[model samples]
Target: MSEIKDIAKFHIFSSAYFASAVNKNQYVTDGRKEIAFIGRSNVGKSSLINSLCGRRKLAYVSREPGKTRTINYYAIQSRRTVDEVEQRQDWYLVDLPGYGFAKTSQENKDNWSAFIDEYMRKSPGLTMIGLLVDLRHPGLPIDKKAYDWLKTVAPDLLIIGTKGDKLSRNELHKNLAQLKKLFPTNHAPIAYSSLT
Candidate 1:
């Protein structure tokens, strides 16, 4: 298994206030390639984003499940030198709310479902969906459902197993094998240590 450091070249540029409960229409408009981060509640999705961007608090991390309730768009800009001119390419790091929480209100779940579905389906800049799973746990019912749902919607998908630091070498391999056997999908799952 190749290390995650070899594959993920991520940087955090800036966090945007596209929208909130106040104004849902104020979402990001800049045409940018986006890759969304998704997972079940308490799977460390925000922590993974923070680590990937080399920031400690770029995305909100919370103890409570389903802390994120909106579609967050982080602007990523890269410079390209062309003909003595500097060209900037825009991209986004999208964070979607975690799912499968039993305590969430019905209204909240319905709203988040609609928001996720709309964004995943309609966002023209969306490039891929990064599906996150806790390495310690096997796939749950909601995890399978989410994977299938994303596969149905997104053209590209990346499955990420979080909390690699907590597992031993053999444990990691065993857990990964279990995931492979259970999911049995085309998407490749990568191990990630957000604390690393």
Candidate 2:
């Protein structure tokens, strides 16, 4: 973790909006590593991405849910050490469409679900998945289903607990504990708050 932070701090990190893919054929596959972000509707997925990149409004934020209907890609450039040699690397940050309780048409929801499933199963460059969940409401049935799917298809998923700022310290800890219980042997949930 320290090494990664050092690399990020030392390198010039710049990201630009790449392409938005509505289908598998339209996805960018230029041989760059990809990290995907996914979550339920209005779970602050965009805000989390913006915060990670240290750029305000890099990912579009909306007051309404289900605004992102496609798989949005952002190209990233940075420098890192490889085998004791420093080199530049290009990667992508993929923002996948949200699931659960979206006030969209059933057809649209089904389309998004199929697209997300296909992308998860077929994207060769995919390296990691960031699964965001609101801390205040930790265990929705949709979240459980998503977790189970990822467990089978993409076991290298990182659970991110969003909206931590909305909870008190005790509540945050308790919710995090519950989250850990859901994925007991997996990596611990990352508590994230856009405010701090």
RMSD to the true structure for each prediction, in A, is 4.2, 3.1
lDDT of 2 by residue, 124-157 (tens): 8887788899999898888988888888776367
**Candidate 1 residue-wise lDDT at 129:** 81
List the candidate 2 regions with Cα displacement exceeding 4 Å: 1-12, 80-87
User: What TM-score do all the candidates reach, one by one?
Assistant: 0.82, 0.88
Q: After superposition, how far is residue 30 of candidate 2 from its true place, in Å?
A: 0.9
Clashes of each: 0, 0
Worst 10 residues of 1 by lDDT: 1-10
Judge candidate 1 against the unseen true structure and give its global Cα lDDT, from 0 to 1.
0.74
Candidate 1 — which pairs collide? none
TM-score of 2: 0.88
Task: Judging by TM-score against the true structure, name the best candidate.
Answer: 2
For model 2, state the Cα shift of residue 118 in Å. Answer: 0.6
